[model samples]
Target: MITFAVLFIAAFCAGVQNALAGGGSFLTFPALMLTGLDARAANITSTVALFPGQITTGFAGRKNISDLPQLSFKALFIISLIGGVLGAILLLITPVSVFEFLVPWLVLFATLVFLWGSFFRKIHENPKPLGPLKAIMAQFAISIYGGYFGGGIGILMLAALTIAGLDVRTAGATKNVLGGVMNASAVLIFLFSSDVAWTQVMVASIASIAGGQVGAYALKRVNEKRLRICIIILGFGLAIGLFLKAHGS
Candidate 1:
């Protein structure tokens, strides 16, 4: 009961974070690890558990979604699906020890990426949009990463989309949709994996869905800058804790 309660709270917060800025895995992944799963198993379970909430959040912001001039949304969607499948395959084949060793570094890298995207990246007054080839390439790489680990894919996509000429609002909405699309492919693969913690997945998924609704509703009303700062701090703190844990072990 305590485990379920903890997972529910963590997943709920993750859902809200994901809807607002896109680093929910930072929460769910660690929470699962604390529940006694190994790093790879935790990651797989986190991806599967959070997927439904992602869809809900994306759908709630569908109105702001738009296609890039360089690439159609359909084209990007297909790329995400293919790349996600490939990444998932790679993850499944990765040894547990290797993944555990990589987890801390991955979290750190993702935190830095999110920090840069959230605060440091400057939008030019007359930004040049990425060409079709460049946009496609970027999206494919991000999709693969999203499938494999998905720490900061949301901000990564937002940066890519904004560079491709969408406004912040549009990029955010599109990012939400594409994030779900890529993860949908991963979830399909993870559903069959022996690593998934279905009991935790069930509890987390329900809590996350409820939290997504709250987050979607708060998207406009909440102070995003403040929320993003909180996420950044949490991310960095988690990264440090994970590194220490890894070193001690």
Candidate 2:
């Protein structure tokens, strides 16, 4: 009962954070680890658990999504699909010790990228546009990362899309949709893995879906900037905590 309650609350906030600015894994992943799963298993379970909420968010934002100026939506979608499959395969073969060692650093890198993008957005109201080739490359790389770990993937996508000359709304909607696509592929691959905790996945999935709806509705009333900052703080905190855990063990 206690574990379920904790997971429910964490997943709920994760859904809200994912809807608002994309660091929900800071909550869900760690929450899974604390539930006694090892790092690799936790990561896989988190991906499966949050998938339904991601689908919901993507469907809800479909109307506002658009292709980048240089790349068609179909091309971008294909890149994400292929990248996701490759990443998931790589993850499945990775050793548990190796994954545990890498988790903190990956989270730290993602946090820094999220922080840098936030700063970049604030400093340059009209940043120079990214070239099509550069944007496509970035998307492919980030999609692979999304499939492998998927902590702050939305931040990565939003940054790439914004650099590609998209406005905030369009970039956000595009991120949500492409995120769902990447995860959909990854989930299919992860389904065959033995590491997933189906019970936690089911609990988090249902809770996150409900929370996503609430977060979508709360978008009208919430201060997005504040919510983003809170998630960033949570990301940093989780990264630090995981670093200690990894080193201590």
Candidate 3:
């Protein structure tokens, strides 16, 4: 009962976070790892479970989306699709233990990226306009990282979106949509070879969806600076926790 409650509470909180600032994995991933699943299995299962959360975000934002920045959206979506697929493929091919060492650093980097997102944008950029070819390649590359282990893909995506010239809402929407695509592709990629906690994922997903609706409504009422600070605080905490878990364990 405690385990079930933990999963539900985590999912609900993560759903709200994902809806507001993005990074549902911050909660769900650790929760899964703490379960009996091995690191690889936990990662794969977590990616697979992102679908429902993405769906919730998409639906909540549906009405506000009048036009999808067609050219850019297609460019980004295609790129993300290819990247996500590749990430999944890489996971299927790579050995699990080989990745265990990388998680801590990746999480740390993602944490820093989120904590200093605005600064990262102010100081530097992706160098070019990121045409179709570049867009596809970039997303594909990020997807590989995301599929292999998505600790802070949201932070990475947001940074990328700035370069893509997408506004905050559009970028968030695009990220959610592309993220869903990545998770879906990863699901196919790991279906046969990996262990998936379907029962736990289903329950968590439900709670996340319910909480997401509430989040969509809440995003409008909240102040952006306060929210960003709160998210950064959580991101920092998650980063430290991951560091300890990776090193201490």
Name the candidate, 2 or 3, with the larger TM-score value. Answer: 2
Clash pairs for candidate 2: none
- The weakest ten consecutive residues by lDDT in model 2 span 219-228
- In terms of lDDT, which candidate is stronger, 2 or 3? 2
Cα lDDT of model 1 by residue, 101-179, tens digit: 6656766665676577667778564546789999999999889878888876665676677668776566767888888
Against the true structure, what is each candidate's TM-score? 0.83, 0.84, 0.80
Q: What lDDT would each prediction earn against the true structure?
A: 0.80, 0.78, 0.67
What's the distance in Å from true for residue 202, model 2?
1.2
Question: Per-residue alpha-carbon lDDT of model 3 for 121-140, expressed as tens digits?
Answer: 56555445435555566567
Which residue pairs collide in model 3, if any?
83-140, 87-144
Clashes in predicted model 1? 0
- After TM-score superposition, the amount by which residue 143's alpha carbon in candidate 3 deviates from its true location, in angstroms, is 1.4
Candidate order by decreasing TM-score: 2, 1, 3
| Candidate 2 TM-score, C-alpha based | 0.84
Count of clashes, each model = 0, 0, 2
